[model samples]
Target chain A: MKIAIDAMGGDHAPEEIVKGVEMARDRYPELEFMLFGTESEVKPLIQSMDRLELIPTTEVIAMGDEPVKAMKEKQDSSLVQAANAVKEGKADALFSAGNTGALLSSAIFIVGRIRGVERPALATAFPAFGGPHREFVFMDLGANAENKPSHLYQYGILGTFYAESVMGISNPRVRLLNNGGEEDKGDDVHKAAHQLMKNTDAFNFLGNVEAREIMEGTADVVVADGFSGNATLKAIEGTALTMMGQIKEAIKGSGIRGILGALMLKPALKAMKHKMDFQENGGAVVLGVKAPVVKTHGSAKANAVANSMGQIQTMVEGKLVDKTAEFIKENADKLKVKKAAK
Target chain B: MKIAIDAMGGDHAPEEIVKGVEMARDRYPELEFMLFGTESEVKPLIQSMDRLELIPTTEVIAMGDEPVKAMKEKQDSSLVQAANAVKEGKADALFSAGNTGALLSSAIFIVGRIRGVERPALATAFPAFGGPHREFVFMDLGANAENKPSHLYQYGILGTFYAESVMGISNPRVRLLNNGGEEDKGDDVHKAAHQLMKNTDAFNFLGNVEAREIMEGTADVVVADGFSGNATLKAIEGTALTMMGQIKEAIKGSGIRGILGALMLKPALKAMKHKMDFQENGGAVVLGVKAPVVKTHGSAKANAVANSMGQIQTMVEGKLVDKTAEFIKENADKLKVKKAAK
Candidate 1:
């Protein structure tokens, strides 16, 4: 399989991106990379890696650039070129640690969406507790902020497919992210979406799951609109960071004993940190699209980029995009018929 | 000053409820309590304490009961009676560690909304980092599941007053809770709300605030619709719990050195726990109401209940209801005039 890499993006750009490609090449000998970036910067970093092919691009999309405009105008930019490679069938997947919006725009406009899909959602993987599953899928993580009930229902279907195909979960219990677990909870959109999802036999529906119960691993796929999902995702991230900061302060204030305790608890603390780290989780995938497109954090280093490559490889090997397209094509007519009947 | 107590509410009921009242009475000698519950269950717990009056009632609202229906039918229930006491001017405020929905129902139906207030919001305090202010107030924490742009604008006004008066923060910076900090972020409702808030001089509007910046003390007041706010609030709570659970597992898996390290770091961990504890932050306050009504957690023990009482006492002493009424009355005409001009 071949993966397209946007090397002129993220904090550690060309250097880390090239290093990551090298690492992935060493690990997965069957996999190849088409690195897109300025030749001068990316060429030195390649270091005679045989499996890697440099696709030189002149322009670079800055982190703060407007997404749609940048994608449209910066045709020669690494991000756009990388996405185009997937569009032209030169690469199986597109990977980037660039400006999220720009990457999303490129993925949607360049890599394209699956047939019969209204909107593609960005799916984030969050670590879960009290279940055999290590993590669950949360979708629309900021793709389409304003979503109709139909959009949300589609997210459930897309999330279900992604969970089953990519995450290797069978049946992948899907639940609507809501204020309360009860059937009669949430706003009008949620209520309508819940009913639609409940009536469908496309996946395992587990009713509405509250945000407090989400981390408890109550469901494998939690679907929500982009707005609520983004807020909830950030809230979880912020709370974890705040708690860790508070713990650090506590350790600092405890004098000599605290310093010794820190040394003894280093391994445990490291383990906990690793568990909470986004780098370990690879990156968020843009589902409902024609091809696999992963967006890692802009600050992601070599290891995280390598993990993202591995994740993309898995998605490609598992034929997630093809499966999603087939599912949507098969069920789109049935869903419309059901809606008309209702 | 007098406060009404729902003695038969919460998991602990009369035992912890009466104990909390006693603790509050001892701490604030100027305050008196009107405990509402069955005399058989509450009288023994009261222990003939001075300034404590047991108002006997027969009915009890279960935790799982429908809020509106329970409040209407269970008129003689402790939750209903306590709210009635505040409405009747027999108590300065009402405090409960009960079914949150029931308490909110009673607060709205019995105690009533302040003039010009369309909906009463539930405001929760979250701890902040690296600031003189230890916490900030987040509003509409699950009061109205479906909120219009106007409702969110009103929340800003209500949240501003609650923060300044009750939280004792003068000229508190108010922000709209959105998917991103950018002005163009969020759904349609948020965009309209942002425009409304920006046009107003009633509060120190700080534009949009993302969920990730909430715990970092970026703003003094974060206003969101009930759906997003509740999801964000629960996400924070769940993340904290999950992290603590993970830490426990880590310590257990780390052998004797880790156990000894835990002992040495016990005080620091305890301090960190206290900071994150809901009891330390008191409880969510029902804002835009005629009286200060606070709802503690359902499983609240004596200390949490006591903290909630103290919070209510502070609200009553600061005349939060009167101030809110004044602010609304003063700004209502101006807001209308501005709307007409627009």
Candidate 2:
């Protein structure tokens, strides 16, 4: 299997992306990689032999550029070209750490979405505590503007499948993210989503799950609208950072107790930090596309890029395409019925 | 000053509430207290006191009980009676650790709204690290179901005055919460709110702020419609709690490194815990109302209740009512213009 990598994207750009490609190629000798970027920039970074190929491109999409406009105008850009390669079946998957919106639009416009998928979503698997712990998949991190009840139901389905196929979780417990833990907690959209999840036999639908419960590993698949999901993801990130900062400040405070405690708990704090770190997971997947499309953070480093590539390889080896196709085929009549009901 | 306490409205009910009232009465010699609950339940807890009085009734509102239904049918309920005390001018403010929805609706329906205030919002000042060490006031915590652009603008106005008066922050920075930092980041409502805020002269508008920026002390007032605001607040709370739990687990993990680190960082982690703890703030003020009302967490202890009562005293002494009135008078014409433009 061959995966296309956008070497001109992200903070580390050619350096990190190139390193990731070399690492993945080295680890998996049979796997092939198609690197897209300027030849000059890609040459020095390519240190390995065999399996790896270069698809040189002249244009680079800036992180600030309008996604739709950039996708449409930059015909020769690395992002669009990489996406086009997947659309044309030159590569099985496309990986990028560029502007998320640009990547999303390119995937939707160029690579095209899988049949029966209405809206694509960004799904992240956050690490959690307690038993049965590999964390849960939450969508859409930053995709659609407003999500209908059906969208949330679809997110639940996609998230569960992704968890099962990608993360190796069986019978993932899907949940609706609501303000309160009760059935009547959320507003109209949430209420509708809750009802749809309960009524549908598509997956294991856990009743309404609160934010606190999600943190405690209550659900394997958490579903919400794009606005709430994005806001929730960011809030969690900010809160974690804030806690880390506060922990640092408290350790630095000029006092005997502070110094004593800091000395005693240094290792414990490091353990805590490692557990909450998002870098270990590398990047999120823009699920529901026809082919695998991993959207790494724009500021991702070499390790994150490598992990993203590995994720794509793992998905490919696990036969995600076939599983998704089968799932869609099996749920076709029900999906159409759901559409009509909506 | 007189304050009404919902003696039977929390997990601890009359026991904690009575203890809080006793503490408040002892701390403030001249302050009058009226405790509301069923005579049979409250009499046992109501010990002899000079300044504290018990207004025993026959009704009680359960935690899971419907807010509007309880308010309408159980007129003599402790929560309703407490609100009635404020409405009858027998109390300066009302405090409840009960159903948030019940308090908000009862306050609006029975106590009445301030003139020119279209919808009274439930505002809470969230603790943050910044200059002068002030907390940002977020509005419509759980009041409105769906928020329009206009409601956001009003929430901004209310939050600004709340910070300025209660928190004593001059010229507080007001920000609208959005999915992205860009102008075109959100749906139509966010764009409209941005335009309105840019045009309004009454606020120190700071444009758009994403959820991740909140912990970095982005603004003194972050405004959003109730739905998003409530979801964001809960998400943050969930994230903080989750991180704290993870930190605890990490420190307790196997090996001497984890144990040593947990020991060293014990004091520091405690400090960090205190910083993120909502219990530290005591209670959240119900802003945009005619009079000051505070809602403590339903599971609050005596200390939280006492602190909330103290907050009421400080707000009253600070002339928060006059400040809110002055703000309404000043921004009346500008709000009219914005509405007209819409």
Q: How far out, in Å, is residue B54 in model 1?
A: 1.0
RMSD of candidate 2 to the truth, in angstroms, is: 1.9
Q: Which candidate leads the pack in TM-score?
A: 1
Each model's chain A TM-score: 0.97, 0.95
Which portions of model 2 miss their true places by more than 4 Å?
Answer: A254-264, B254-264
Model 2, A42-118: lDDT tens per residue? 88878875788888999999999999999999999999999999999999998999988999998888888778888
True contacts kept of each: 0.89, 0.67
lDDT of 2 by residue, B10-58 (tens): 8988889888878877777767888888888888876676787889888
Question: Over the stretch B34-64, how does candidate 1's per-residue lDDT look in tens digits?
Answer: 9999989888777666998889999899889
Every model's DockQ: 0.87, 0.62
TM-score, model 1, chain B versus true chain B: 0.97
